[model samples]
Target: MLVLDLVATLVFGVSGGLTAVRLRLDVVGVLALATLTGLGGGWIRDVLIGVTPPAGLADWRYLTAPMIGGLVTFFLHPQLDRINATISVVDAFGLGLFSVAGALKAVEHGLGPLPSTLLGLTTGVGGGVLRDIVIGVIPTVLRKGELYAIPAVAGAGVAVLGSRLELTTPVVAAVAASVTTGWRLLALWRGWTAPEPVRAAAAP
Candidate 1:
């Protein structure tokens, strides 16, 4: 879990730092955004699950991954800029990994399937949402016709079902992460979109 968590953190941190660089934020702001994007979801999950002090606060690695990400982006963003689309793809991978990991952890902690799944979704999107809100942008998960949160829920559901069926954690997580990442990547490739509220036609 720790390994998966840290891997997810690094990718998310890079994405966050890239965003900050694209927006021309200062060094401190870039670092701050990267840290929040890397650890915010885990912190929120830990707090809600009664893990006080949060891993983000207690673990040096959790804090350091984002810092390194920020530094890398700060120094290398000009080259990184050529591959913005690639960053989004990596962000999708992080989303998948985190959702499965979070759901499995919640289940381990005795959370019910429903709560575990919901918490998993939160864990997947919370960091990106935080990063977006801090930068005054609408969260991608909440955007109209966005295809983000549903993939998270689907991935979390797989983990929840696997747990209920007594599957091993590693196997279940692999399946769930694959489902989420594949779905997200396919959606991006095919321009698949979530539903948006329809507006009735107005009288002329």
Candidate 2:
């Protein structure tokens, strides 16, 4: 579980750093994005549960991970830019892992199903939201199409249900994360989308 958490943080930090490079942000912006992506979800989760200061703020390892991510990206931007698909793959994996982790942690903390699932979504999507907001764009989760938060919710739901079925925690986490990542990749490859909202008729 500790390894999974670190991997998720690294992946998210890399994704955020890549986005910052695309936006031509300065080093500060890049570092900020990496930090936010690496720490934002857990920070939010802890805060909501009344954990003061948050683990990320208190833990040097978490803080250092994103710094390393930012430095790697800063030096490798040109090479990484040539392979945007690679970044997408990493981001998808991070999303799945974080979502499952968040859901499991929430349940461990005695949260109910709905809130647990929501926390999972927030964990999966929160970093990207912060990254996009930094770059002044609406989040991809709110846009017309994208697997994004939908897969997070689905993944978390599966994990939570499995928990109730007495499945081993590791097995549930693995299955949920794998399914979410698969769904996201398939959505990207095939352009899957949810139905768009139908606007109500204008006053007439």
Candidate-wise lDDT, in order: 0.88, 0.85
Question: What would the TM-scores of all predictions be?
Answer: 0.92, 0.91
> Which digits, one per residue and each the tens of the lDDT, describe model 1 over residues 112-135?
999999889988999989999999
Best by TM-score: 1
Q: Using lDDT as the measure, which candidate wins?
A: 1
Q: What does each candidate score in C-alpha RMSD? A: 2.3, 2.3
In model 2, what is the error at residue 87, expressed in angstroms?
1.5
* Colliding residue pairs in candidate 2: none
lDDT of 1 at 64: 92
